[model samples]
Target: MLLLLIGFGSDSNKGNKSTKLTVNETFVTNDKGVATISGKTSPDYGVNIDNAKQTAADSDGKFSFEYNLKGNSKKSLRLEVSKDYDDNTKKSKLIYVKPSKKFLANRESLAQESSRAAVASKSQRKAASESSESQKKAESEKAKVESEQASDITRLSEKPTDEQSAILTQLANQTFSKKYPYKGSKIHTILGNIQPWTKDGNVWFAKYEATIANAFNAKRDATLEIRITPLSRDSGNVSFEDY
Candidate 1:
């Protein structure tokens, strides 16, 4: 009877050992501070982490749980595994919980990229605004200069002096040469007509009928208008019309 009792006690101890819980040491968390705890225990055993609801181990004795560590100050978690058959509970080694190094690095990089994108967006908007203002100012100045030029052209001029007439004739000949570049082309004469002369703040205007001959010596009559800026005698506009 004594040997049988000892053997029974040994078998009871073996049964208790079979129900003990085991856990893997690898614990991981993300940048958002969610932690994963996983381990092994007797098949169908109830497993719980801290105050979380219990879950049953799988047929393979594997169990896993996720816990939000966002506001939790503790660096480790207590895991409990139990089996109803034995009415016993087992505690696992403390599972260390912390953000993974890779998670932290990725989060920091994302933040920096977001900051740089914001700055670049602001700079682009500023540059576009300044460019628009500059364009408007340039257009305004151009319109003002054009208005002044038109007013000058409408101002009356005294009768052309001999010197001015000579300048006008020379300009007409040069214009004819450029327009009809064939070597033999020439301007025969320039004759004054009504509304023939005018002057402006910066330029003189003359109109005349011109007789020209082309390279083939075919003569044609046309009206010509000439503008001369006395300050730069060679720089002005010349046009021919009324052929």
Candidate 2:
């Protein structure tokens, strides 16, 4: 602390060779918080706080503001400074008005804790994934003993398995063979392609069946899509819903 004070004193005695005006913070605490802008400059230097607001500067470039939290609060603070013979003014960094305690040690500790927490969370997620893989392997081994993978794949991939499709084709052939036996109605559409939901030796076929009696109004007409989708991979079950 003594060394720092001595160094600060030494810096004060140094000749003013810079005209840059800087504030302590880019953000302020309350709606109305003073910004202590202290810098080194010549004796006669002009510092502008706002765009054109009146400013006060001491012998050096040191300046301050006793701002108030007005109803129409300022979103940011713009500070600028200019010296004699200098054509342009140097603007300071945009000061965002926000709540800040200026606790350097606390901020550093919080950053460190956040990094540690992120590492710990990653480790926890890795452990959880490894545990899941182990459980999946165990379940696979047990399933191999009860059911054959080849048989399940063969039955699942069978084509033309829709209940409504088979029923409609069968009925159509029967009607054509009995009616003219030479001319038949064109099979244009199917309303619902009912599917069979099989599980635990029980086969439940769809109850509704619709045949496009004609091609008129076919685009607007809805077709029933049949599918056998697994409800849950673990349970080995499927449910059928018609739209």
Candidate 3:
């Protein structure tokens, strides 16, 4: 704990003034694996955990704490202390614990760097999995697009029919299709699906349906819809706003 004491004394105009400060050093290492420090002194000091919060010092201005420059603590650390906050003359010299030349000499300790390596490995694994999943989705969407094209040729256009105008105005039931260049591309990549040339003519038709709906709402950028059903097995009608 940080301790504070004020001594009361009388001052004489002709007398000399003497001040003495005895620093009781204690060590607190930061989580970065650097050197421990007594106070918030200069040089560098740290704690064992990856943080820089000040823990209270023990009595007599003495304290002991682990250092952390990083999560690992096997590195050297230095701490400087002075009588005042900015006492250049009272500055302490660098306190070396061990040089890199000494630590790198031990292969067994160097091997512990594997801990950092593990973090890198985890990130790579996640990236690979995501890439694989994306590849699979692309394949699926491509096949679906091809199948959709064959069905789209015989299907009616996305333009609102005379009958739909009354309904469109009443229920705001704007027709949207599962087609677009970017949408087709994304779906083809995400689901690994393809569309045939027959549906190609109507391909732009499906694309326009979604575009028109958004255009009606006066949106400049296009958007896609996705559905997330936890238990349902069958494909449900996905609304463009479902996402």
Candidate 4:
């Protein structure tokens, strides 16, 4: 009977050793501000961290829990484990945790990059606005110039001055000479009466009457229409068509 009691006592000691809880002494917080506490305990044992809610170990006697540092640089954790079959509860040593240096550095770098991107975006928007305003201003000036030119053309076509009339007569004679280059062909008086017509606002057509003698000495009255296109305020292009 004494030998049997000794063997039973040794078995009890082995059971207590197998149920002992073990935990990591130190942990580091990740970039997400969370620290993971892990430990080994008896299978299906209830594990508690810092007196919080209890969690059960897996079948393999492994357990883990995440603790939020709440943006703190350092934190302390205590853990306890208990099994239904064991009357004695096991406790772990104080666990220390600190934020990882690599995490902090990466966070700072990302913040700086974000700040630079924001500045660049603001500058781009400002530049785009300025460019748009400049383009609008240029377009407005161009429209004003076009309006003035159209007005000038309308005025000139309605009532030509003496100098303008002389220029028109010379242009007409030159055009007639090109078309009728016969050796003895000659033109008499170009018409004094000029009637101007226009299709579009920018161009004018004027009809004139004249007398011309061919190389055969046969004389006939001729009618011609001239197209006048203003090149600028002081210059124009002239073309002729027989009417």
Candidate 5:
């Protein structure tokens, strides 16, 4: 993609001006072992390589020609341009040529190496992606277990409701027995509904009412308080007092 031009001026006093030549390309090769030697020269000069005649310069002092190379290794192709071959001759630079088989093998080897590197890079990326996904899954399972444990602790800390009615009623009756233990008075009736329990720290407390009858068959209502301490999810200890 580069262009260069040189000019020569003729002097009328001088018999004939020296012809100059300039090459456009440094080296070239094709599949058929044919090399193209092209350049520009002064008007009316015959161009040749190693004394083999080629095309003459055109109106714009431009000429191009082809020569078939006959060698299996590196060699130099020489160009010469002259009007008559004695002293006004111009020679071109030597262009080195490489063997076609060696050039093709080197090209193929480079291509295969590039392909293998690409495949290795792709496999490494895939393995990294899989490892990342596994780590994320493990973290998700750990978080879920921690959340469930937290929920269980919260439930244990709150007040109990209908699920605890049996324990509350039993504690109320036991409270009446221990406080008002009149020999003539016997247990009469216990109320079905009881007051809700309250929690402070790990202790539970409740207040309830019950009725007692004397030996004369007279009934009276009594108030009782109960306290409970839980040891686990399904077991606890209870204590009662009368008010």
Candidate 6:
């Protein structure tokens, strides 16, 4: 990557912006022999692969392309970078694509890792659900003891304030946006319901459901739990995680 940057600089005029492109090691392949190449480049740069596949960078200069290497023995690729299809301003690089064996191995490893993660996530959600159930059960059992002599009573409060709702929504959006298909695909996060209950007054929890669509076109949904601990009347710390 550094060598490519230096070569680009040496080949470009001083006043002109040097063609800067870096291919991160995010290449992946499957048994079908198709490779997905992803990386970043200078913003607004036009990228072409072997003079066939072409794409323009996003506002942040990130780019991704999928190339089918099925049944091809040749392992080299030509990456050409330019702006507005100007050949005179193009910088080309010869990239030796990694062998399919490496990509397959990596894909297998990733599949295993994803399987493990799904299992772990399932366990975590189950545990959280059980914990919440037990807490509710304990509270119900304590209701008998909360007679006239009880010190204080827990209460169900109204919906969160605008500020609190905004903070929670922001946190949820960020968390959901960082997840899979939603990370890149044009997806909207629709927050469903907010259920908040408080005891004493310091710690509070708000549970909500979010629907993510892009990969499945709104057929899937996810539940999130947000914990809000108020430090004062107007401020607090908010944290959340996907379940």
TM-score of each: 0.35, 0.28, 0.23, 0.41, 0.32, 0.33
lDDT per residue as tens, model 6, 58-129: 888888777776443546777777778776566666664444676566667878999999999999999999
User: Considering only N, C-alpha and C atoms within 3 Å, which residue pairs clash in candidate 1?
Assistant: none
**Residue 64: error of model 2 in Å?**
2.7
Candidate 4 stretches with Cα past 4 Å from truth are: 1-26, 30-34, 45-56, 65-97, 153-243
* C-alpha lDDT of all candidate models, in order: 0.63, 0.44, 0.35, 0.67, 0.60, 0.60
Candidate with better TM-score, 1 vs 6: 1
lDDT of 3: 0.35
Clashing pairs in 5: none
- Using TM-score as the yardstick, the better of models 1 and 4 is 4
lDDT ranking from best candidate downward: 4, 1, 5, 6, 2, 3
Predicted model with the maximum lDDT = 4
Which candidate has the top score in TM-score? 4
- For model 3, how does the per-residue alpha-carbon lDDT over 1-243 read when each residue is reduced to its tens digit? 999999875321111122122233333333223454444322232212212334433334444554434332333333333333334423332333332333343433556677668888999999999999999999999988765543332333444343322222222122233332223222221232121111123222112112322323442333333221211221223233422
Which residue ranges in model 5 land beyond 4 Å of their true spot?
1-99, 154-243
Q: Using lDDT as the measure, name the better of candidate 2 and candidate 5.
A: 5
Question: Quick one: ranking by TM-score, best first?
Answer: 4, 1, 6, 5, 2, 3
Superposed on all Cα atoms, the candidates' RMSDs to the truth, in angstroms, are 15.0, 18.2, 23.2, 14.8, 17.3, 34.6
The superposed Cα distance between candidate 6 and the true structure at residue 39, in angstroms, equals 1.6
**Candidate 5 per-residue lDDT over residues 99-213, each given as its tens digit:** 4664455556777999999999999999999999999999999998765544332234456654454454455456556655655433333452365566757777766665555
Residue 20 shift from truth in candidate 6, angstroms: 1.2
Model 4 global lDDT (CA atoms, 0 to 1) = 0.67
Which portions of model 2 show Cα errors greater than 4 Å? 1-35, 39-62, 65-80, 83-102, 148-243
Candidate 1 lDDT over residue span 14-44, tens digit each: 2245475666554667766677777778788
Task: After the best TM-score superposition of candidate 5, give how far the Cα of residue 41 lies from its true spot, in angstroms.
Answer: 6.3
Please give the lDDT score at residue 45 for candidate 6.
Answer: 82
